[model samples]
Target chain A: MANPVWMVLRGVCRGLHLTGYFCAFGTALFGALFGQPPGLRRMGWGGFGVALLAGAAWFWLQTADFASASSPSAVLAALPLVAGYTRFGWLTLARMGVLLLAMLCAQKRCWKLAAVLSGIGVLGQAWLGHGAAMGGGKGWLLFGCSLAHIGAAAAWLGTLPALALGLRLSQNPRALAENYSRLGLVCVGAILATAFLQYLFLIGRVSAFFTTAYGAAALAKLLMFSVLLALAAHNRNRLTPALPASRAALGRAVAWEIGLGMAVLLAAGVLMQFAPPAMAMASMGS
Target chain B: MRRSLFAGAAMVMLAIAPAAFAHAYLTTSKPSAGTTVRLDTSSIRLSFTEAVQPEFCAVTVVDGMGTHAETGKPEAVPGHDDELTVPVHFQMAGKYIVTWHALSVDTHKTHGTYSFIVGN
Candidate 1:
C-alpha cells in the first residue's frame, strides 16, 4: 500500500524538477541576450559568488540519490542537500532575479551586461569541466579548477562570435586586421590551456580519445575545433590583408569558422546531458 | 536607430519563456506544520506531489533549542511512496521542528519548514 505522503511527495518532486530546469537554464540562456547574467545581478561580485554556490548546490542535489531505504550514508548526505539547497540555490537565485531587475533599471552599459553574463558562464564549467583522470579525493574540486576550465573556454569559444561580428560590422581592412590579430593571440593561450585540462578530465587514457561516448564527443568537438582553426589561419594569412573590396571573400571565410565553432558548442550542450563515467563511478550506480 | 529597444524586447521574451513551465509542489506534511502535539512520533513524514531524490533531499528533526534529535538517519521508503519518511528518536524535545529541502532532477532546489511541540 502506498502512503498519501509518498503520492504528494512524488508530485512535488516532479514540480521542483521541471521548474528548476525551466528557470535556471532557460532563464540563463535568455538572460545572455537580454543583458542580465545567467544567475547573478550585474555590476557586482556578490551576485556572482552566490550564483556559483547555487550552481554547486544544485549540482550536488541532482547527482545524489538514496539507494536502500535504510542506508546511513543516504540519510546523512540528505542533510547537506537540504541545508545547501535552501540556503544556497533558491535563495541565491531569488536574489539574482531581484538584483538583475535592479541592474536593468539602473545601468546603461554593454560591458556591464557582458560582465554579468560572463559570471553566469561560470556554471558551464561547474556543470562540465575537467579533472576526471584517476582522482582520489579531488574529484569535486570545481571552485578553482572549473573556473579555469570555463575561463579558457569562454575566451576561446566566445571569441569566435565576437570576432565574426567584428568582421561583419565593417568593410575596413584595418579594423578587421586589428581585431583578427587580437582574437588570434587570445585564442592561442586559451585553446592550448583549456584543451589540456579537457584532456585531463574526460580523456584520461589516451585510448579514451576513441573509446567512450564522451571520448567520441570530444573527438567530434576537436575535429570541429580544428576546422575553426584552419579557417582562422586562412583568414589571417590570406584575407585579413586584402583590401576592403576583397574583404567580402575574407568575411565569408571567417563567418564559416564562426559557424563551425557554434556547431561545436551545440554538440557540447548534448555531451553535457550524458552522465560522466566518473560521476557514475562515484555514485556506484547507486 | 532603436537597437537597445530591440535587445530589451528580446530579453523580455526569453525571460518569460521558462516562467510558464511551473513545477509540482508540497501538498502537505504531518504531524502537520504549526500544530501542537503531545505524542512521540515514530517517524517524520512529508507528502510531495512528485518523487524526490531520497539521497539529496531530506528532513531533519531539530529540538527546542535547535539541536538535531535523530539518533540514526532519515530514510525514504521503498516501493514508491509519495511521502518521504525520516526516523526521529526525539530525544528530549521541547519544541521540535522538521525542516525539509530537496533538489529535483530538473535541477531546482526547494525548502520548507514546520514546527510542532512535543508536550502540549
Candidate 2:
C-alpha cells in the first residue's frame, strides 16, 4: 500500500492520462472516419501531448511506490529495476511508446494511420489494468471486455468536441446529428455491456460489493455512468433531433457529459489501484 | 482553460490518495531481505502482507558463484496462506541471492530480489 498522498497523486495522474489518451484516440478515430477538421486535428494533438506528460508522471510515481523510495534521485535510480523486472513496468513502457508513435502520426496529419496506431496503444491499456492477470481463456475474455469498454468510452467522450465542431461547420447539422446519434447509441450499448461483464468478473457475489474498497468505488462509478447514460439518451432522443434550434442545449449537454465522463474515469483510476472485492474475500476465506 | 485542466488533474489526484491499495509486501522472512546467515542455513521462508497463490508464487536462490542454490519448488505453508517455504541446497556459500515472485489472491503480481550472506 502507498501513502495517502502518493495514492491520490497516482490516481489523478491515471485519471488525466486516461482522459488524454481517450481524447486523442477519439479525435483520431473520428478524423479517420470523416475528413480531418482543423479543430479536431488540434484537439487530437493537444490530447496526445497531455497524455504523454501525465503518463510519464504516473510511471514516475509507480516506480517510487514499488521501490519504497520518495526522493527524485532515488526513484530515478530504481526505474531500471522496476521497468526491467515487473509486469506493470513493461505495460507502462509499452503504453508510453505507443503514445509517442500516435503523437508522431498525428503530427504528420496522417489521421487514419494515427487512429489505427493510437487505437492499438489505447487497447494496450487493458494489459496494465486489473483483469489482465487472470490465467488462460478467462484472462483473454476479460481483456476483450476491458478493451471494448474503453473503446466505447473513447468513441463517446473523446469525440464530443469533434461532434460539436461538426454541428458548427456542417451545412446539414441535422443530418450530422442524426448520424452521430446512431453512432452514439452503438457506443453506449457496447459500454454498458462490457462494463457489466467486467463488474460481474470483479465483484463476484453481491455481498462483496458493500464490504470491499474496490467494490464501493466501482459502485460509485456505475452511478456516475448511469447519469452519463441519461445525458446521452437526452442528447440522442430529444436535443439532437431539434438540431440548429437545440444547438446550445446540445453543446451544454455534451459539456456536462464530458465532466461526468471525467468523474467516471477518476473512479476507474482508483478502482484499478486496488484488488477486486472477490479477491479480497477469497484471501479472507483462506 | 489550461489552468482549469491542471487544477482538475491535481484535485482528482489528491482526492484518490486514501482509497487505493494493491499488491503484497514482504512482512517477514527466515533469511530476511538483506542479512547475513550461518553456513548451516538450509531453507528460505517469506511471509507477505497478503495471501498469495502457491501455484503462482516462486522463489529462486543462487549463490555468489552463479550456481543454482535452491532445489525443487517453493510451497506455501498449508495453514498459513501468506508464508512461502523453499529448501536451499548449497555446500559452498559466501553470499546467496534470493529472487521471489508472488501473485496475491487478488491476482496482483509482484517480484523482488535481495542478497544475504551465507557466512560472515
Candidate 3:
C-alpha cells in the first residue's frame, strides 16, 4: 500500500488536474458553440496553466509511488526510467504536450481548434486510468466507455461556469440558457450511458459497492451526481424558462451545480486510488 | 425523461458483454506459493495478469533465518513483459519466503509475499 498522505495528495492532484482540464475544454467549447463570452478567455488560460502544473505534480507523485522512492533525489533518478519506459509516463508527457498546444491555439483566438485539442486532452486521460490495464477487445470497450464518460462530464459540468457567465452578459439570456439546457440534456444522456458501462466493467458485483473503498467512493460520487441531476432539472424546468426575470435564482442554482460537480470530480479522484472490486478480487486470488 | 435515460443505461450495461479484469495481479509463480520444492530450484519466477515494469519492480527471497537467499535484481524474462525472475541460492533447506513489489505498466503498484518449503 502507498503512504496515506501521498495517496491523498495524488487524489487531490488528480482532482485539480481534472478541474483544470474541464474548465479549459468547457470554456473553449462554450465559446465555439455560443460565441465568446467576456472573461472566458482568461478563465480558459488560467485553466490550462493549472492543468499543466497539476499534471506535472501528478506525474512526479506517480513516479515516486511507482519507484517507492522517498526522497526527491531518488525520485528524480527514477524519472528517466519511468518517463521513458512506462505507459503512464508516456501518456502524461503526451497530455502535457496537448495542453501546451491547446493553450497556443487559445492564445491565437482559435476557439474551435482549442476546444478540439482540449477535448482530445481529456480523452487521453482514459489511458492513464484503469481502462488501460485491460487488454484486447474488452480493453477497447472500457476505453471507449471512459472517453465518453469523461467527455460528457467535461461538456456538462465544465460548461456550468461558462453558462453562468454567459447568462449574465447575453442580451437574450433565455436563448442562451435554453441552448445550454439542450446541450446539457445530450451530455446527461452520454454520461449516464457511459457511467453504467464503466461501473459494470470496474465494479462487476453489487456487493463490492458495500465492501470496497473504491465502491464507497463511487457511491458518494453517484449521490452527488443525483443531486446535480436534480439541480439541472430545476434549472431546465423552472429556472431556465423563467430566465431574465429569475436570472438571479438561476445563477445561484448554476453556482450550486458547479460546486456539487466539483465535489463529484473530487470523489472520482479519490476513487481512482483504490482498486475496483473486480480488480481487488483478482488481487486476492493472486 | 431522466428516469427513462437511467433505466435505458442500466439495460445497456446489463446487455453488454462482460469485461475482463484490469490491473496487474499475480497469476502464477514457479515454486508455487505454499508448496514444497526440491533443492534443485534455481530461481523464483512470477507471472502477472498484466505487463509490469521490471526496472522498478523488486523481488526478494529470504530463508527462515531472515537471510537473503536471492542474488541480483529482479529481471524481466526476455520476450515476456509480464514475468519476472530472480536467481536464488538455497544453502540449508527450511522455509523460504518470496516477496515481490511490482509496478504495472499502467503505474499501479502491487506487492505480495508467499512462502514455500525447500525440503529433500
* Top candidate by TM-score: 3
Please, what are the lDDT tens digits per residue for candidate 1 over residues B26-115?
556667766666556777667653345454566778886778876555455676434577767666647887777753333333467667
**Model 2 lDDT tens row, A65-105:** 76667699998997887677666676777876776687678
DockQ of 3: 0.42
How big is the positional error of residue A91 in model 3, measured in Å on the Cα after superposition?
1.6
Per-residue lDDT over B41-87 for candidate 2, one digit per residue giving the tens place of the 0 to 100 score: 77888877556656556788888778988887888788786789998
Docking class of 3: acceptable
lDDT of 3 by residue, A1-286 (tens): 2977778789878888898889888988998898787898888888888888888888889888887788999999989988888888888788878877886887778989988998998888887766666656777788788888999999998888888899888899899998888899999999988887788878877787898888998999999999999999999999888878999999899999989998998888878887777653343324
Q: What lDDT score is found at residue A206 in candidate 2?
A: 61
lDDT of 3 by residue, B10-120 (tens): 777666647456667787888888889888778888888777878888888999779998988999899787889999888888999888888777667878888889997
Q: In model 2, how large is the Cα lDDT of residue A246?
A: 88
lDDT of 3 at B12: 75
- Point out where model 2 deviates above 4 Å: A280-286, B1-120
How high a TM-score does candidate 2 get?
0.73
- What does the lDDT read for residue B65 in candidate 2? 72
In model 3, the clashing pairs are: none
Candidate 1 stretches with Cα past 4 Å from truth are A1-107, A110-113, A120-143, A277-286, B1-120
TM-score of chain A of 2: 0.91
- TM-score-best of 2 and 3: 3
DockQ, per-model, please?
Answer: 0.03, 0.06, 0.42
Top candidate by lDDT: 3
